[model samples]
Target chain A: MVKTDGLHFQYPGGEAFDFPNIDLSAKDHLAVLGPSGVGKTTLLHLLSGILPASSGTIFIGNTEITSLDRKALDKFRGSHIGLVFQRYHFVKSLNVEENLQLRQYFPSKLKDKERREAIAERLGLKAHLKKKVTQLSQGQQQRVSIALGLIHKPKVVFADEPTSNLDDVNCERVLGLLKEEAKLCGSSLVIITHDQRVTEHFKNQVVL
Target chain B: MKLGFIAYKNMVSKPLNMVLSLLLLVLSVSLVTFVLQLSKQLNGQMDKNISPVDMVVGAKGSPLQLVLSSVLHIDSPTGNIKLNEAEQIIKHPFVDSAIPVSYGDNYRGYRILGTDPAYFERYEAVLQQGRLYKTTFELVAGSAVALKLGLKIGGKVVSSHGLAAAGGEAHDDKPYTIVGILEPSGTVVDQLLICNLKSVWDAHDHGDGTHGDEEHREDESNLGNEEGNDHTQENERHHDQGDKEHDHTPDDDEHHHEEEHDLHDEEKEITSLLVKFKNPIGLVQLPRFINENTNMQAALPGFEIQRLMGLLGSGVKTLNGIAMAILLVSGFSIFISLLKTIRERRQELALLRTYGLGTRKLLFLVLFEGLFLAFIGFLLGWVLGRLALILVSKYIEAAYGYVLQINGPEFVELLLLGATLLIAIIAVFLASTSIFKLNISKTLGDA
Candidate 1:
């Protein structure tokens, strides 16, 4: 669950640009659509606790995340939330298994072996577990990022333009998998995108 | 800990750079250690020769030269002082005991000392075999001198005219028999040949009677005529017979005692004298007394050692400063490399942040990486430094005439090395701002 009241954020050392109020709840699939420089990414950062909001209160599962300090924010983010980037952000020096193992860096109560096997099985990454992230193809690397994001069965998942480079077939397939997996885990999915393909998958959408 | 491991791995990744940094570290440390050790060794040798006597009197010149020639068997005398003048000084109420020394000859760079049996006893030189020379032209060999020159007891050796080995006249006919060997003192005494003062005087007296070899050579050349050679031959024969008579003479025999006294009165000559005071008050009192009362100067061995330390230490300090500066610059290079790495890996960092890693933890990781590099570099340097010491020990000993001990690293050096690692770690922390200010949302979008 997530909620934001009058969430205002502005880039420092530049002209100020304010974002509008936002509100969302559990099992919600929210897609934020906006042009470049309209604070589409800025809004997502405020909700996720990665960037501090200029003025507002952000409640995630009834906890005031905006008021938390840096250390607490990081712990809260890693445990309760999962993020998928437009470009997969796997560490180049680490193999796929190590990158996935990093998913356990944060606090978690899940069994390590069970979580590892489940993520690998679901993402079809079992075959390339020993390969370095740099050695993987774009599609395979994306699957590894997806596996890393959902390893802990987080309550909230944030994806920003995750399928921008995928073809229509893979894009539709990835969207379907994200929606199905989020529902199974009892998590809400928030995707930020300008693509029309994102609109077709989610009935619930927010336009900025 | 995690960051330190990664930093170590990164440093080792570039093997050439790692080797180069360690090479510089080892070289600088060895240079400092070797130079400091050499100065200590040289001062120790000087201290050994100086310890037996507390004061030295000679004709007015550098006191160090007098001490060096008279005690350490290096350098030539400033000038010979009158034996009566030396005796008068030694007879002072403050005088404890004095031994006269005469030098100007060497057996292949090993000094030959001309003094009494009391001189050897005062020096506490132990005889390894045989007995002290009781007759003229007989000698006692020092351990090193005997071993190095391949001379055994009863073997004969000739003295070179000059103090050094090069370009010296050899007194071939007056070859001395090695009657005894002195036990090693780990001092300059280990490189000297001790004999009675009369033997030295007789060698000059009967062998053309000259102080220098040139004069001895001139007399021999000028006396080459039939009558002159015959007279010299007669004198040589008489000299040998006189030596035999002196050997058989009793220690307290009045006739021989009177003859020695007559020789002392005729030639008022001595190479140098060593003096010692009864109390610590002599340090302040005697230096002033010797400096003003007579032409002779008094030098404190400890003062000269400290002066030498100061001179060498400043130069060493300058070199150490330059080394520190280079180490700092290398640390900066490490910082820059890490900073750039974090910047280029923003998406990866953001991913880790989403996994509950805090900004503080991330910054610490970078710092650990830097510290790890420095730690490894220091270890490499320490090992290499000891290896270098072993390799150059013989060469250094030969050139400076001082021995270097092979041992573990000094504590001060270890502390300095640790400080360098700490500085490098701090630099890495400063350079990690790129990751500290990272925007997870923008990085995700850019991905």
Candidate 2:
């Protein structure tokens, strides 16, 4: 579970924002809807402990993420929180299987080839396991990005504009896979999006 | 799966950039290593060639030229001095030993020296075959001369008029017999043919068996007269003898001994005298005394060799500086390449941070990349240095008869390799600071 109270942030020499409180249960999903320049990515960054919240408390599971140091936050974030960005950023030199293995590597987790294959099979990436990320098509790359985010079975997964670049059909398939993967891992899902089409998919939603 | 694997992939993905940086590094490292090896070898050769002789005394001329001619045998002699005068100098109380050398002839471009057995003893030369020269017209060839001329004991060689002269006047009436061959000593002796002083006198003797003093004075004034004179008288006397008569010798010991004494008394001249002082006192007093009071010039081998090294050292130092500058520029190039790589890969680095790679691991990844390039460049540079040394060794040996040992690694090579790696690490660290200060969210959001 993730809980945020009186969340607010002020960028240096820029505007400040006072965000609404959020109460998210495990295995649930929240879509943050906003247009451009509305601090949608900033909110995700703050709740994920990537950007420190100026005046608020964020609790993921039992630990208050805002009270953690940089190093502890990094470790906590890596093991318990996952991030998926709009661009599907990956080490382009690595193949699909190796990319998943990299996520497993940093958490000091055993490289379970069976687990990797299972995740790849679920995302329909089994046939492209040995292909470099750059060789994959847009839909295949999007599924691989979801696999990367959920590989370690984090308790909370935060995605920033995950479907902005996809068409209506790819966007639905990507969102369906992300929600199914999040439910499979029993993790809370927070999707930050500017598109209104995504608002109907999540019952619990936040608007900036 | 490892960070190193990722770093390697990132480096090889842009092969052209990595190769350009590596090539510059290899060139700089090889240049420095080559200079170090060459300078060491050249200095070693110079030290080995400088014998233990304290002073070289020759007829009045340039001291350096006299030292070069008398000690190293690489220059023309400074005319001839009277043997009696040199003998007086040798008898001084402070003199330990003196060996006089007489040079005039050559056999197939190898110099023939008329000196005593002490010359062989001075060089620690051992006879590889046959016996030393005990009579006039008997010769002992050095190892290089024997090998080059295909000469053995009892072989005969006619002397030419001048040192290293081809098709010059030949002493056809009397040829010197090779009596001994010396082992290789890595000295000037290896290129010489040793004979008794009388052989040179007999070969240049132009008088008609009558007045020895007049002949000596005539030979002293015009050393070339013997070469210009017709060989009719000397040839006729040798040609009339039958083969058995030519091989015969006088049986009476007393008469042979008297003849040897008479030959010694004849007006003999030598080109130069090699002197060694009994103590340091002679070093201060002998050269000055000889220069002020005698007709000969005394050349100090140590002083002359020091001057030569001083001149060559300046050149070596300048080349070493240039090589170091090239290495510094190579370091700068690596810094720029790494900086550019970090700039281009900022988004990817941010992504890695989100995946749980700590800042320290990221820093080490970049550091290892630089070290890897340095290691490869250093190893290739070392091999290239050895190859260059092989080429230079062949040339130096062919031109100067000095061998350079280039097979082993020196201590300086290891030190240089360490220094190169250190510089590479520092360069990488300075360039990778952009990775440390990167704001992950901003970079990823911008991307």
TM-score, B chain alone, candidates in order: 0.71, 0.77
Q: lDDT per residue, candidate 2, B288-392, as tens digits?
A: 999999877798988997898799889889988888888888888888988988888888888778876778878887887888888888888888988988998
Which tens-of-lDDT digit does each residue in B1-447 have in candidate 1?
Answer: 144444454456456655654455455545555554555555666676677777777666666655655666555656556567677767766666677776666777777788767676666788888889988778998777777788788998888665666556676757899999888767766778888766665444433332344544543453332222212232343345444444322233454444444443436355677666666676667767877977555666456545655887788678767766666666666666667666766777777787787887677766766666566666665666566666676674443333446666677767767776777777777788778678777776666
Residues A60-173 of candidate 1 have per-residue lDDT tens digits of 888899999888888888899888777678766666776676676555534486667676778787888888887888888888877776777787888878788889999987
lDDT of each residue in A55-132, candidate 2, tens digit only: 999999999999998788878887888888788898877788988998887856658888899989999999999999
Best by lDDT: 2
Relative to the true structure, candidate 2 reaches a TM of: 0.79
lDDT, residue A204, model 1:
73
**Model-by-model lDDT, in order?**
0.68, 0.80
Name the 10 consecutive residues with the lowest summed lDDT in model 1 chain A.
A102-111
Model-by-model DockQ, in order = 0.43, 0.59
